[model samples]
Each structure stands twice: as structure tokens, then as C-alpha cells.
Target chain A: MTWVYAVTLLILLISLIVGVWRVIQGPRLADRLLAAQLFGTTGVAVLLLLAELQSLPAARDTALVLALLAMLAAVAFVSRVWKVRPDSEDRP
Target chain B: MNLLIDFTLLIGILAIALTCLISRSLFRSVVFFILLGLMLAIGWIRLGAPDIALAEAAIGAGITGVLLLDTLGHLKKTGNLENDEPAPGRKRLILAIVSSFTLVGLLLWAVFNQPTPAINIHLLVTEAMPESGVSHPITAVLLNFRSYDTLLEVGVLVLAVLVGLALQTDQQAQDSLPGLPNPLLHACLTLLIPAMLITSMYLLWAGADRPGGAFQAGAMLAAAFILLHISGIKLSSQVSHRMMQAGLLLGFGVFLAVATSSLIGGRPLLTYPEGGAGMLILLIELALTLSIGLILLSLFTIANSPPHHKDQGGDHGH
Candidate 1:
């Protein structure tokens, strides 16, 4: 079971790396923001796996906080940042 | 397997940090920084420090990310987002590299040549735990044993908010970012806000026996407040100005008052009376939680508010 957790965590970390590539390669701000959102969700999964693997319950709380704040960046980007760049709105 | 996990985390953290530092796009840098924070939180957990992990999650990743993104928005509004900042000259790059390498070398040297402690401070904390008024060692250490440090830290937070407040030329300036008028966001808030509030209180309650505490709880509360503010539920406007000011000062005031009371009792300042340490710590934490929340929200709002002249110009133009 611990090994299973380890493998799952490894997979999530790999996915995070993949997500970072999108953020780095983005020709669009929305693409980068979406990749960041992927990180948030993946981060929660990693935290939860760590909690189970290490038998540390507080890691679960960290996951919960991550889950809650996951959408915040998107909200901030849309309402604050993206709204200002009207030109970027029509870009693919 | 554990070694593999640790190795991956190390590489990921280093790579993310380097990217954040070197990324030409400010927005990309901010995103990578947030990702780096997430990675660090996991690193903290791997080191068996869940308290620090929680703090990293709440403040480092959550609050700091929002603040940076908001700053980016401000920069965009001012047409400075794409301004070509001059690349570092060769001399400056060499200086930076040399200084950073020197710091890293010093750190590595210190790590390799650690001196044995004259005292087993962990043992002392364990021995004194029964008298420290809390079951959790971290909380007991933070709010009970080394509470003076916590008091000063709260004072610093309060001071930071005060500086931000002072910098605002107009107290009543409205936030330039209009409320997000999404119905889905509003629907989500109905559920999310309550959960966040409950979690904040639970964190405060858990501190007595677990890893949660005032600072983490306060950050959680601040996140909820900021969410509401972003979604158009302006907490600042809902409450009176006097009331908001009082809320911001409540934690530091209560902490100072308690510390002074201890001094008057000849307990050498900040030393709680016998049998009252637990209650006093709880009281201080409760006040700190509220004040920290208000302080963080104020910082966000102060940054979000438009400049006084801009507001006036827009008003006259309209």
C-alpha cells in the first residue's frame, strides 16, 4: 500500500511537470492560468497521497486549503488581470 | 521508493524556482512561484513538519499568489505589464551569481559542520509540556513557551497593515477591480465561505492538541474574506469604518493588554498567571485570528483601491 501511494505520488509529480511545461510554453495568458489551475488540483492530490503514505493527518488539512483556494487564482485572473487585456480576449 | 519521491521533489522544486526567477513574463513567473510554493509545502510535509506545511499552503501558495496576481493586474492597468525592463548588465549578473554562490557555500558549510547543542531544547520542551497549557508541542511552544515572539510577530503584522493603511492617500477609495458578477461564483461562495469559516474555527480549536493554530486559521479566514471581496461582497463597505479599524487592531491590543497585565502582576511581562496560561493563550489566539484576518484583508483592499487622483479624474470625466 505504501508503495502504491509512492507510485501514485510519482505519477502526480510527473503530471505537475507536464503542467509546468504548458505554463512555460503558453502563447496565451489563459493557457498559463489553466495550467496553474491544473497544478492546484494536482497539488491537492499529492498532498492527500502524502497524508496517507506518511500517516500525517494534517497533510489532509493542507489539501483542503489547497482545494479551497484552487479557484482563487482563476477568479483573480479573470476579474482582475484578464478583464484589462481586452485585446488578448480574441486570441487563440 | 521514498528516496525516489524525495529526489523528484528536490528536482521539481529547484527547477520551478529557477524558472520563476528567470522567466521573462512576469505572469509566468508568478504562476511558477505559486507552483514552487506547492512543491515546498509537500517538502515540508515530507520532513514531518505539518505545521509549516499548512502555513506554506495557506500563506505561501494561497494568499501570496492572489496578491501577486492582483499586482500584475495593477501593472497591466498602468500599461507597465509589457514595459521592457532592461536586462541585467554583465557586471550585475556576475555580482548576483557570485553573491548567491557565496551564500549557498556558507549554508552548505554550516550544514556539514554543525556543532552539538549545549542543551537539548527538545527535551526541555517535552519536560515542560505539562505546564505549558497545551497538548501540542508546537502550539505550546509558539503561544505558551515562546509567546513573546508570537506577540512580537503579531505586532509586526499589525504594523505592516498600518503602513499599508498610511500609504493609502484616500481612505474611502474604492477597489478598481469590479466585483465578479458570475452567478456560479456566487453559488459556490454560499457553500465555500461557510466551509472556510468552519475550517478556520476548527484550525483554531485544533491548535490546542494538533498542528493547526492562530496564523493558519487567520489565513484561512483572510482567504474567505478576500473571496467575498472579489465576488462583490465588500466586507469593508458592509462594516462601518470605525468598526473595521477596531477589528484590525483587536488582536494586537488584546495581546499587549495581556502582556502588560502580566507585567503589573510582577510576572516579568508576558508570563501568564499560574493556572491561567491556557485560557490566556486561547484568548490571545482568538483575538489574533480575527485581527490577522482583518489585517490581511486590509492589505488586499488597500492594494486594490485605485489612486485618489485617478478616482477624482474619472469622476470629473464622467
Candidate 2:
């Protein structure tokens, strides 16, 4: 069980890394926002797995809190991106 | 056998995460990420944490999805979504790879090295289950024993909304619903809204007896709102009116009211008076589920960006 959890987390971390690449390499702000949202989602999964490792219920609550906060962050980022960038059609 | 299921679920999660990270279209990535959240919710259940599972399904998959879709919409309205030339950065790829390895190494080391504890307080709560009216220890912890945490959590949620409002667009007049409409979409909304309401009520009522609670209930209500949005039914800012606002705080309010009243009786806050305590807890949870759901949905709706065209091809309400 522990091995599976470990491997699963490892794969999730890899995905987050790739997402970080997108965040940096993103040509448009939307892509960066998407990458950040991906990171947040993966963060929630990581927290849940950690909770299992520690056999702690509070960890799950923390994960829940993180998940909610991540969603909030995504919304904030999107709004910010929208405010900063002009519509694509406006560009030459 | 259960471990095998766990392995399979993990694989599914990995696939979704990879897709979410690498999808060509930003809108499609957001949709996939929401699906990924749902898959992760199932993963939580496989790991024997139904409380986490329920909460994830509601907030993680349901409300978060709406917010993402909303952002995608906003991007669409701005016409900023496009596959442009890659930013001048091959160095970023190297940095991402190196940091990813660093992160995984740290996680593996910590998971392996951490000493397992001998006793878990959750078990203690289980043992003392008879003293509390609630059957589920987590619920008991959430609403009774650790009711203070639950109260503060709701406050955190409210604060997040306040902050989100301050940070995001203040377009109170522009409804957050998707623009397009389809007959099938309408059918789904008609079917799902009632189911959401019933399930939310059931979850709140059964919270003391089972795995449901305010968080789960709030998520369900949020899910219903998401369904409404995707179907193009916009909720005005006044969606949750004055009574609705009060009801949204019902869980915390009742808990505080009962807890304070108990002070006169020389009891701690959230202390139940023997047999009648279960009803009080249920009432609070029910009101809270309603209030929390509305507040969360309102937060996402207000924060939601208009949908971009490409997001339409992604998963629909699953």
C-alpha cells in the first residue's frame, strides 16, 4: 500500500514539474494560469497521500482547505490575466 | 486486492494530471484538471477517507471546475487564448526537470524516514464515540468536539471569498453563466438541480449518522450552481438574498448560539445537553450546508471568467 502511494505521489510530482515548465514557458498568461491551477490540484492530491502516510485525519482537513484555496487562487489568477492582457484580436 | 484498486486509481490520476499539464489548449486543460479532481476524489475513497472523498468531490471537482471554466470564459471574452510562439526559454525546461527531481527526492525521503506514531487521536475519538451523539468520529470532531475548528474553517472560507472579490473582477452585474445553450444541457440541469438539493439535505441530515457533513453539503450546493452555470442560467449577485445570507451562516451561527447558551448551563461551547444534542448538531449542519454551499457557489460565480470557445470541446458536466 505504501509503495503504491509513494509511486503515485512521484508521478503526480512529475506532472507538477511539467506544469511548472508550462508556467514558465507559457506564451500567454492563460497558459500560466492553467499551469498554476494544475499545480494547485496536484498539491491537494499530495496532501491527501501524506495524510495517509501519517495516519492523521487533520491532514485530510488541511488538504480540503488547500483544495479550496487553490481554486480561489486560480480564479484570482484568471481575473488578473484578463485585466493585464488585451484580447488576442487586438494584437497585430 | 484493495491495494490493486489503489494502484489502478493512481494510474488514472497520473494520466489526468499529465494531460492537464500538457494539453495544447488552455481551456481543455482546465476541463481535464476538473476531471482530474474527480478522479482524485475517488482515490481518496480508495484510501478509506470518505470525509476527504466527499469534500473533494464537491469542492475539488465541482466548485473548482466551475471557477476554472469561468476563468476560461473570461479569457475567451478577452480573446487572449492562443498557441503563440514559445517564450524565449529552454533554460526553464532544465530548471523544471531539476526542481521536479528535487521535489520527488524530498517527498520520498520524508515519507520513508518519518516514524509511524503508535496512537492516532482519530481512534480515541472512535473509542469515545458513545459519549457524543454523532456516529462518525470525523463528523463528531467536525461538529462537536472540534466544532471550533469547523467554525473557524467557515470563517476562512468567507475570508477567502472576500479576498477573492477584492482580487478578481468586480463585475457584479455581468452574470457568470456560460453563454451558449443546448436542449440536452437544459435537460441535465433540470435533472441535476433537484438531485443536488435532495442529496445536500440528505447529507446534512445524515451527517451525524454517516460520512456527510457541512463541507460535503456545501460542495453539493455548489455543484448544483455549477450545473446551472454550464447550462447558461446566470445567478444574479442577489442570488443568495438576506435570508439566504443568514442561512449560509446557519451552521456556525447555531453552533455559536448553542455553545454560548451552554455557557449559562456551565458547559463548554458546542456541548450537547445529553439526548437532545444530536438534533442541534443536525440543524446546524443542515443550515451550514445550505449557507456554505451558497457562499461557495456565489464566490465561484462572481469570480468566474466568461468561457472561451475551445473550452466547449472539453468534458461536459461529468
Q: Which candidate tops TM-score? A: 1
Native interface contacts kept by each candidate, as a fraction? 0.67, 0.02
Which candidate leads the pack in lDDT? 1
Best by DockQ: 1
TM-score, one value per model? 0.94, 0.67
Question: What is candidate 2's CA lDDT for residue B233?
Answer: 65
What docking class should model 1 receive? medium
lDDT of 2 by residue, B206-276 (tens): 57776777777777776666555544465553355556556556666766787788888997766788887
Q: After superposition, how far is residue B192 of candidate 1 from its true place, in Å?
A: 0.6
lDDT of 2 at B274: 81
TM-score of 2: 0.67
In candidate 2, position B186 carries an lDDT of 63
Q: B101, model 2: CA deviation in Å? A: 3.3
Error of 2 at B184 (Å): 4.8
DockQ values per model: 0.52, 0.05
